[model samples]
Every structure is written in C-alpha cells, then in structure tokens.
Target chain A: EPEVTQTPSHQVTQMGQEVILHCVPISNHLYFYWYRQILGQKVEFLVSFYNNEISEKSEIFDDQFSVERPDGSNFTLKIRSTKLEDSAMYFCASSEGTGRGGRPGELFFGEGSRLTVL
Target chain B: AQKVTQAQTEISVVEKEDVTLDCVYETRDTTYYLFWYKQPPSGELVFLIRRNSFDEQNEISGRYSWNFQKSTSSFNFTITASQVVDSAVYFCALSDFNRDDKIIFGKGTRLHILP
Candidate 1:
C-alpha cells in the first residue's frame, strides 16, 4: 500500500538554529498535515495544507513555523529558530479529500521524524 | 473545541486475556469522526479503525471489536484473546467535519500483553 514518507528519521539541532522537516505525501492525496508529539504527551496538530496553502493552524504553529509545498511531491515544515520545547516526534499525514472515496475521512500517517534540540 | 480522552494510562494483560481500551470525546459538531490508532515501540502509527458519528452500530473484525455509543459520546475498543503482538500505545482521536479536518489525539493508553 502507498504510504506517506518523511525524510531525516531523526535530527539533532542546536537551539536557535534553523531546522527543516520534509515529507512526501501519497501521490494522489489532496490534503496534507503536520502534527507533533512531545515526549510522553498526546499528539498535537500543527497545521494543515491544501491547494498549496495553509488551511488551518494551531497556537503552537506560531511565526517561527512555516510549511511549504515547493514541488508537486514535496511538503516541508521549517522552524526558523528552534527551541528546547521544539524537540518532539513530528508526523506527516495525508488524505483524499472528504467524500472523494467511500472512506474519505481516513488519514494515513508516516513513521514520524524525531527532532532533538539541544 | 474537540477533545479525546483515554483515561487508562497503562494496562498489562496475560496472553489470551481479553482487554478493552476506553475512549471518551467532547465535541459540539453534529458531524464528526472517531478513530483508533496503534503505535508500537518502533514509534510508527498504525491506523486501526474509524467510526463516524451517524453510525452508532457496533462493529466486529476478527478478534477486534468497537463499540460506538453516541448517547454517551464514547467509542471503546476491545481485543479478545489478545497476544503479545497486541502490545502497543493505543490512541483515540477525534475530527470535526465542519472544521479543517484537523485530528486531535488523546493521551494514549499503553498496553503490554505479557506472554
């Protein structure tokens, strides 16, 4: 089965440095999202992207965070300045827009990218 | 606002024992969806099941079954004759159709199936 794929399975960066997390969603998927989970915490939604634009974002997705679909296949999340609290497992997910298929609401997630900030 | 709550922090069960993971949610939207996902030690998320608000009927798939009760706003999952392979962190999630379809996950329930 086709699945979402993310690059840099694990990353270590210095505080105040820039970091970029990349994801390649399923080819046919129309909606994409970025979610993060602090160690021992629940998964939190960051932002959602559709039609190459941000559809919605959470408070955690502040000015420091940005997402881009630079190409047809690559979707990326960039943190201009990383903080200790930025360390977490970031997940990439995608779905065929609602009602496109009988099960349109289902989201397929990728094996997350673990980010460690020091 | 939408929220999913998994009250059981951790559970241990002997092989072949039946186990159930509870999920309670709060949502004002009339149209929404609930889902169950599993995250093994490898830290990879595996989608298990999805139930829409309109469909309150219970469903069974092999040794796994789901109970959706709209009246109580709960969707619980049960595993019958569970094995060691069933050990994982299970997460219950909620998504509102009227919103941007952002899924909110609850603190997971870690299940350890002892052999």
Candidate 2:
C-alpha cells in the first residue's frame, strides 16, 4: 500500500534553534495536515494545508511555526526557534478530499518524527 | 469544539481474553466523522476504522468490532481472543464534515496483551 513518509525519525536540537521536518504524502491525496503529541499526551492538531496554503491552524501553531508544500511531493514544517516544550512526536497525514466515493475524512499518517529540544 | 475522550489510560489482558476500549466524543456539528487508529511501539499510526455520524451500525471484522452510538456520542472498539500482537496505543479521533481538514484525537488507551 502507498503510505505517507516522514524524514528524520528522531532529532535533537538545542533551545532557540531552527528545525524542519519533512514529509512526502501519498501522491494522489489533496489535503495534508500536521499533528503533534507530547510524550504521553493526546495528539494535537497543528495545521492543515491544501491548495498550497494553510486551511486551518490551532493556537499551538503560533508565529514560530510554518508549513510549506515546497514541491509536488514534499511537505515541510519549520519551527523558527525550538523550545523545551516543543519536544514531541510530529505526525504528517494526508487524505483524499472530502466526500469522495463514500470514504470521507480518512487520513493516512506517517510513522512520525520525534523531535527533542534541550 | 470537537473532542475525543479515551478514558482508559492503560489496560492489560491475558492472551485469548476479550478486551474493549472505551471512547467518548463531543461534537456540536450534526454531520461529523469518528475514527480509530492504532499505534504500535514502532510508532506509526495505522488507520483502523471510520464511522460517519449518520451510520450508527455496529461493524465486525474478524476479531475486531466497532460500536458507534450517536445517541451517547460514543465510538468503542473491541478485540476478541486478543493476542500479543494486539498490544498497542489506540486513539479515537473526530472531525467535522464541514471542516474536514483537521482531526482531533484522544489521549489514547495503551493495550498490553500479556502472554
């Protein structure tokens, strides 16, 4: 089966450093998203991207966070300055657009990139 | 506001035991969707099932079954004759049909099937 893939299975960075996580979504999907989970907490929605722009974002996705579909296949998330609280597992997901052929809102998630900020 | 609540933090069951994971969700939208995902120790979110609000049907697939109740706003999953391979963190998620871009997930229930 085709799957979403994320790079940098694990990353460690110092506070105030820049970090970027990469993801390659399933080729035919039209909607993409980013979510994060603190070590032992629930997964939190960060942002959603479609049509080369952000569709929606949460409070957790503040000024420091940015997402880009730099190319047809690559979707990237960049954090300008990482903080200790930023340590978490970031997941990239994609889905076929809404209400297509009875399958609606089903997202395929990547293995996740674990970010550790010290 | 949409929220998914997986009240059971962790559960341990002996092999061959049947286990059920509880999930309660809150959503104001009349049209919405609920989902379940499994994350093994290897750390990948595997899609299990998706149920729309209109369909309150109970579905069974082999040893796995899902009960979706719109009246109580709950979507629960059950595993019969569980095996060690069933050990994983299970997450229940929700998304509004109108705003289908992002999904809200629960804290997840960690299942440990002991041999």
Top model number, lDDT: 2
Clashing pairs in 1: none
lDDT of 2 by residue, B9-82 (tens): 99999999999999999988999889899999998898899888899999999999999988898899999999
Model 2 scores what on Cα lDDT? 0.93
Per-candidate clashes, comma-separated? 0, 0
Chain B TM-score of candidate number 1: 0.96
**What are the clashing pairs of model 2?**
none
Q: Model 2: per-residue lDDT, tens digit, A4-50?
A: 99999999999999999999999999989999999988889999998
lDDT per residue for candidate 1 within A1-118, as digits (tens), equals 8999998999999999999999999999899999998998899999999888998899999999999999999999999999999999999999887543435547788999999999
Interface RMSD values for the candidates, listed in order? 1.8, 1.1
Runs of candidate 1 with Cα error greater than 4 angstroms are A99-102
Q: Model 1 compared with the native: what TM-score?
A: 0.96
What do the candidate models score in CA lDDT, each in turn? Answer: 0.91, 0.93
